[model samples]
Target: MPQATALYTAKTKRCEARKKKRRMTEPTQTESPDTTPLILDVDGTLLRTDMLYESLWAAAGRNIAATLKTCVTQWRAPNLLKHALCEIAAPNVALLPLRPAVLDLADAARQAGRAVHLASGSDQALVEAVAQRLDLPGPHFGSDATRNLTEQSKAQMLVERFGEGGFDYVGNSNADLPVWSKARRIIAVSPGGTLRHRLEAMGKPLEVVEDRSDPFALLREMRPHQWIKNLLLFLPLLVAHEFGLSVFLAALMAAAAFSIGASAIYILNDLLDLESDRLHPEKRNRPIASGALQIRNAMIASAGLVVLALTSAWLVGPPVAALTLLYMLTSLTYSFWLKKRRWIDLASLAFMFLLRVLTGAVAAQIAVPGVVMAFVFVVFFTLACVKRMTALARDVDHGKLPGRGYGADDFRALKVLAAAGIVLSAAAFLLYAFSGHSGGLYGSQMIFAATVLPLTLWLFRVVRLSELGREDYDPIQFVTHDRIGLMIMVIGVALVILSL
Candidate 1:
């Protein structure tokens, strides 16, 4: 019996050894080397598309303002603009903008032989487009392949793709912390607040890339040169022969007040559009959109600004106050409502420009000349058309305008509007030169005409450039800093002042 048992045991040991050898000889599916991957978020981390929102807002402002005069509820404004822009310029529209730094980092990682993956909550298509642009190879782990990658969904994706030994993550927000914690190495991008401090306490390795500053961003949002219409508000004072220093000072005050109020409106607009802006390519990093400034904080700042605006208006008296209210109403309507309407939207925008001139006149206690009023309307309409035409051109160049709702058809419309603007603009300049007022404003009739020729040519050139998508500028910055335009403008202004 003992001999039989020993024999069986020996045979079992031999069989086990043979099986082990066979397993070792054959290739198995199990991996030996572990992989550490880098996961990045889409909205705040990889790319920003806030500019798309601003552009859409601008388009909406042109289209929506013609309807109701009283404030439109917030709910209506959001959907109205979203639907309108999507319908008008869908080709250039996209979910979000891509960040160059994020791509740079991904490239750096690839060069360093680090595995790269995107763990985002954005739509797979949008993120993939961004990844492709960045040359990222991914079995992506994030939200629905089609929707946005966000919050808890992003963390789960990391686990689903790599399980335990699959990745080390890099990200910029608390939303990423869940996956970051699971990561072998956590490379934090633009870390801050509780998450930053918590990660530090946990002794995680963190890397920070500061956001870039864009000075022209705000001016782009507000379309500042449009403020030139504010100068019209002073026309009444000029006609009243109240062009004295006091009236001039009052007019200046109103302009300043309107600007401040307008800026405050911009902040609010950014806040309301924050989510949509996050998906924009250029606008995502806006001071308001990038999470650098909290919405609560932004609201507080806006309130403070409004208080200052009201104080300035009050100091200027009832006429100034009333005009300020009108300005605020117009701007707010643009920000919230009229921006969603179509041609009516454009009409309202033109009216707002005309009103700015009227306000200046009222604040200064004067009656604006009929020619000046006509000129303001014509010039403003032409410029508005130019602005729309530029946007349409951008949509064409980009192939599509997403989220904002514009399409190729809209681009065609913008082209037509721009052409109309050119014709009307030429007409306005001619009218300005030939009108009887040329003698009073320019000194010599011929002097005004000469200035008009240059001014008209300059305007045409700018419109053409804008239509060609050459001037991808915030209107204010373009008008104020474009040396060529500024120099020509100076000559035109000098001619006008000399004539006066």
Candidate 2:
């Protein structure tokens, strides 16, 4: 008990010393008589994200049960919760997204010989770390063990330090209203809703820094374009020449179910890969990575999508519902574990694609020929290899892929394997076209063989583009947008229809 008391006393003294040093060095309104001090809010103002949520996400990623237990224990003690979370999952200061405009504004204010202070509702330790990382001017204030500095508390503290209307304030949310009322000048960053209306009532802000991101950011996060891959579910119906109303409707429902389930997986993957995504050049702009969408909202959306998918699949058929559940489980496993293992990730992706075709067959109540199943697996497996090759090719630095076993050096071997996969897929198609089932399904099996040519050409084109380091890492997405690929696909489909 005495040792614990001594440790507590030492920590208290250190905190007091730091506060005293800040007070002596940082200029208040009285010390800076010639220039008005500029006070800035941190979360959603100076930075694109809230530190509290970021820390909590990291904590949850580490151990969800332990984090939840800590939350329950410290439910009534905000400061203790903050400390516990910080200790569990401190953010990488260098990777935290910063608002360039806000930083520029602070820099300009400092250049004009004005004192700039960072005041936030976040823990003082976090606030201080952020300020130090950015090399911001003057003292930074934040909630400590004894106080949760925000709203009225923030306003009161600022009023006492700088006096009413003695400073300029920059912030983004409704929580800043009290501080704004106390400031001489108000600068708003990405202000909207009630905050915008209140700022308008007070007249135009000194400056309004607009956030330049797509309004359809949430839709983009869902990646509707990628839903085209789910159309593979219709392939079984097409192959079986079963275009009946019931089969068509069932196929469509299955596609919808798969799309929703895939979206949930995508959201989960994004959340798990937040740190790596931020480090990635292209992925950093993703909604969750860029802080355009809240993690909490994303989690809720993922859960809702999972439930909707299962329900939709159940409406389609019992077999389809089982397949959908299997797909979800496989995808979740791949995302959390298998994706990091060499060869296993590619195999899992191929299996997933095959599952779509199998589910489609079950949905349409059709028994796909063994040769047709072989063809589907080989084709999708090849396409999966192409996807990975493209990703590795574009990653030019030869650096290891985050959370994956592949690297740039593996590109050559992958290309050879992908080529082999393409050849095997063509062989499977040929076998199917020559089989007895082909005679039953088509008037001229010879015409069905024509599909192999276009398929071969499209696969080669995909490989070439990937080797050239093209932007379309997803071969499915590439085919959807590529005019020549689309034309080839149309001709191929037409040939199959002619044979039918």
Return the top candidate by TM-score. 2
Tens digit of lDDT per residue, candidate 1, span 135-234?
6678664334233345555566567777743577767777777777666667666576777788776566666676654545554444455566456666
TM-score of each: 0.58, 0.82
Q: Cα lDDT for residue 471, model 1?
A: 69
Q: For model 2, what is the alpha-carbon lDDT of residue 280?
A: 78
Stretches of candidate 1 off by over 4 Å are 1-34, 49-95, 104-116, 121-166, 193-197, 205-229, 243-246, 264-322, 328-346, 385-500
Worst 10 residues of 1 by lDDT: 66-75
Q: Please state the error at residue 487 of candidate 2 in Å.
A: 4.0
List CA RMSD, all candidates. Answer: 11.6, 15.8
- Estimate, for each residue in 325-426, the C-alpha lDDT of model 2 and write its tens digit: 999999988876788788888889889989999999899888888888888787777777787777777775778887578887788888888898889988
Going through the candidates in order, what is the number of backbone clashes in each? 69, 0
Candidate 2 residues lying further than 4 Å off, grouped into runs, are: 1-34, 59-89, 123-125, 143-147, 156-166, 181-184, 196-213
